[model samples]
Target: MNHFLALTRRGAIALAFALTLPLPAVAATKIQHLISPGGIEAWFVQDSTVPLIAMEYAFGGGATQDPPDKPGVGNMVASTIDEGSGDLDSKAFHERLDRRAIELSFSITRDYFRGSLRMLKDNKDEAFDLLHMALTSSHLASSDVERIRSQIMSGLRRDTTNPNALASRKFLELEFANHAYSRPASGTLESVPTITVADMRDYISRVIAKDTLKIAVVGDVDPATLGQLLDKTFGSLPAKAKLTPTPDVVATAPPQRAFVPLDVPQTTITFGAPGVMRHDPKFMAAYIDNHILGGGGLSSRLYHEVREKRGLAYSMFEALLWMDHSSLVVGNTGTRADRAGESIDAIDKEVRKFAQEGPTQQELDEAKSYLKGSQMLQLDTSSKLATAMLQYQLDKLPIDYLERRSGIIDAVTLDDARQMAKRLWGQGLVTVVVGREPQAAAEAARAPGAPPPPKAN
Candidate 1:
C-alpha cells in the first residue's frame, strides 16, 4: 500500500509507490516465470503500483503461415477475431471494450501473429474473459469478412503505385524467392477475394494453440494469480499447433542491381545483404558495428556520407532485420530520380569503407556509449517491458538478458567490431531502386534494342 510489497518469499518484489501508480526503478526489472497446470508458460513482471495491466502474446505462425493460395487469411483472422465472439455480436463485444476502457488488438507480422491487451486492474477478469472468447469462439461473421477483404484489397492495389511500397515489395520478392517470405503478408488483390469465412476459422484452428503461444504480463498481478489466469485464458486450446513447416533460408539477393521504373520525382531505394542472426554469438559485436556503420542516424557512416556530406539523398540507414528463418542487413534511402545513381555510389562507398576498416576506436567507443544509454529508454515503460520480455523469449535469450545486455555490448573489442563489420557488410549491398532506373540500368536497357558497334580487335 505504501512503499514496498514483498510479492513472495522467492525474491519476487514490487515497489508499491502509491495505491495504483508504478514508479520507474533504477534497478534491473525482475521477471517471474509462471507455468499453468495446463502446461501454459508465461513471464510475469509484478508491478502493483499502477492499477493497470498489459499483456502481449505471439504465435510462431504469422502472415507467413497464410496458404500460398490465400496470402491474407492470417491477417483476416486477426481482423475478425475481436469483431464478434460466442454470444456477443461485433457491436456488443466492441462496445463492452469501449465502455470498460479495455484495449484489445491484434497484428499479423511476417513471422508471428501478435496480440496486445491493456486494462485497469479492476477490469482484468472481464478483459481476459473477453479475450478468451475472441481466441476460442470467434464467429467470423460474413459481412465483416467481406468488408475487411475489400479494405485490404484496396490497400494492396494502392501499393502498386506507391513508390516506397513498390521498392519494399520488390526487395522482398528478390530477397526470398520461392519462399513464404516472398508472399505478401497482406493478401494480394487476387488472393484476398478468395479468402472465405471458413478459411478464417481454419486458420485459427491450425495456428492458434498452446504450443506456439508466448506471453508477457505486467502490472498489478502476482505469479499465483497469473498462473490461474493463464490456464483459464489459454488452457482450452489444442496442445499443439498444426503449423506449416517453413524451410530455412537466407536472404538470396546477390550483389546485383534491380529496379522498378516509375514516373516519380524521387527514387526510393531499399538495399542490403545478409546479416547475423539474433542468437548468433557475434550479434552483440555486430550490433555495435552496425550502429557505427548505419544504425546511428546522422552519426552513421551511410547517413554522413550519403546525406550530410554529399547531399545525394534526403536520408539513408541500414539495420539488421532478423526473421525466424533468415537474417539481413537491410537499408533504404530516397533521392531525386535523376540523382539516384549518385546516392547508390555514395552508399556503396561508405559500406565498403566500413566493411574494410570497421569502426575506428573512437567510433566504437561512442557507439557503445550511445547504445548502452539508449537501451534503458526501451525498457522504461511497463508496456514496453512486456513487449521486450516476449521478444527476449522469442530470440532465445536467457532470463537475465536485460541485466547482462550492457556487459555483452561493452565487451566488444575493436577487433571484434572490425571482424563483425567484415562479416556483415563484406559482400556489399544488394539494392532495389523504385522509380526511374539509375544511370547504369538506363544504359543496360538500351543494349537490347540498339544496334551494337563492331567488336574490338
Candidate 2:
C-alpha cells in the first residue's frame, strides 16, 4: 500500500510538470483591411485551413428609425429583400441557394439591421454574386411584400391571445410608454398595412449604403481576392448613406399594475421599469450584482430561497434590459394558485435583502469567476466573435472592450455591486406573475408593509 501511494504521488507530480511545460505557439490571427475600388471598406480574416467562409453586413438605421406610422416597416422590408430580388424570383433564389448549399439569413434589431451569408469555398464566387444582388437590387416584389406583411399581422393578432406574449408586450408598452423601443420588432396589425414598396425601396437604399455598412469576412481566401470580391459585392452602392435623425428615447415614469385576470391555469405576469443601458457607467457592476441575486441560476439568491428551500416555484430569474433611453430589470416565476402568495413574498424578501445587504465576499467571488469564465467560452467560435464585434461596433464601444472585459468584472467589489443595486435596481422592482391567480397573492401585493415591487409595467 505504501509503495502504491508513493508511485501515485510521483505520477501526480509528473502530470503537473507536463501541464506547466511551454506549449507550441499557435499561428497568430491576422485581421486584414480592404478598401474596395468603389471605396467600401471591409475587414477580412483569412483562414485557409477551413474551406468555409462567413460574411456579415450591418446597416446603421435599425428598427428604431422606421418612418412615422411605419413602425414595423424596417424589419418587414429587410425580410422581403431576400424573398425575391434581382432576376431571381423567391423560388429560384431559394433553389440556387439550396444547390450551392449556401446559408443566408437576415435580421433587424432595435439598433441595427444585419445580413449574413456562409458558403463552401468552392461556391464562394457564385454565392457572393447572389447575395450581392439581393442586397443591392432586390425588387421588393409587391406580392412577396404583401404576403410577408400579412404574416406579420397574423403574428401580431396571434400575440394578442397569447398570455405570455401579452404579458411581455404589455410590460414593454407600459415601461417605455411612447418610446420607440416599446414597439414590437414586428409592427402591430394597424402599423403593418401602412407600409409600401416605395417606402421599402427608399429605406433599403438609404440604410444599406456602403459608408454605413461594416463588413466582416472570415474564411479561406487571399486578402487581395477577398477585397475584389467585396468590391464586386458592395462597391457599386453609393459611398454616402442617408442618415436618419435617431430619436431620443426618453424614460417614462414608473408604471402602475394593470393585471388582466384570465381563466387559465397559468397567469403570465410582466412588469417593466427603467434599468440601465449597455453603456451605462455602472453596467459591469450591475451585471456582477445581478448574477448573485437571480441571474446566476442555481447559485442565485432567488433560486436558493424560492425553489430550493421553500419549494414555492420550480424556476425564478431576473434580467436587465438597457435600451437607448431607458432600461429595466424584470423577473418572473410561476407557482400553484395557493402557493403564489408565498412565492411572491419569498421573492420580494430576497430582493429587499439583496438591496439592503448586497452580496457577500463568497457570492461576489463566485459571480466574478463565473462571468470571466463565461466570457472566455463566448469567444470560442467565429460566429460568436462576429456577433460580439457587431454589437461593439453598433454601440460604439472601445476596441479593447473584449480584452478589458475581465478587468472590469474583476474590479467590481462587493460594495460597488451593492451601491449599484441600491441606486439602479432599487428603483422599485416590477413584479410579474404568469401563473394561476391567488387571493393570497393579491392580498400580499396590497400589503403596505410588503416591499414595493420594482416599477410595475
Best by lDDT: 1
Q: Taking the tens digit of each residue's C-alpha lDDT, what string does model 1 give over 206-317?
A: 8998888999888887777778888889989888999999987888746877889887657788998877788788888988887788878879888888887777787777
Clashes of each: 2, 11
What is the per-residue lDDT of model 2 for residues 1-457, given as tens digits with 9 covering 90 to 100?
0000001111123223322332211113545566766666766656654466667778777777787677887888767888767888988887787777677767776656777777778888988898888888787787888888887788888887777777776777776677677787678778888888888888787788776788777667777778788889887777777867666664454435656555444455454456667787788888888778887888899888988888766467777765444567776675654565566678767877887788889988989999988865664445445555655655567655666778888888878888987765455555555444567546555778866433211
Best TM-score goes to which candidate?
Answer: 1
- Runs of candidate 1 exceeding 4 Å displacement: 1-23, 437-457
Could you give me the TM-score of model 1 versus the true structure?
0.90
What residue runs in model 2 are displaced by over 4 Å at the alpha carbon?
A: 1-38, 253-255, 337-341, 432-457
Alpha-carbon RMSD, each predicted model: 8.8, 11.4
Candidate 1 residue pairs that clash = 20-49, 21-49
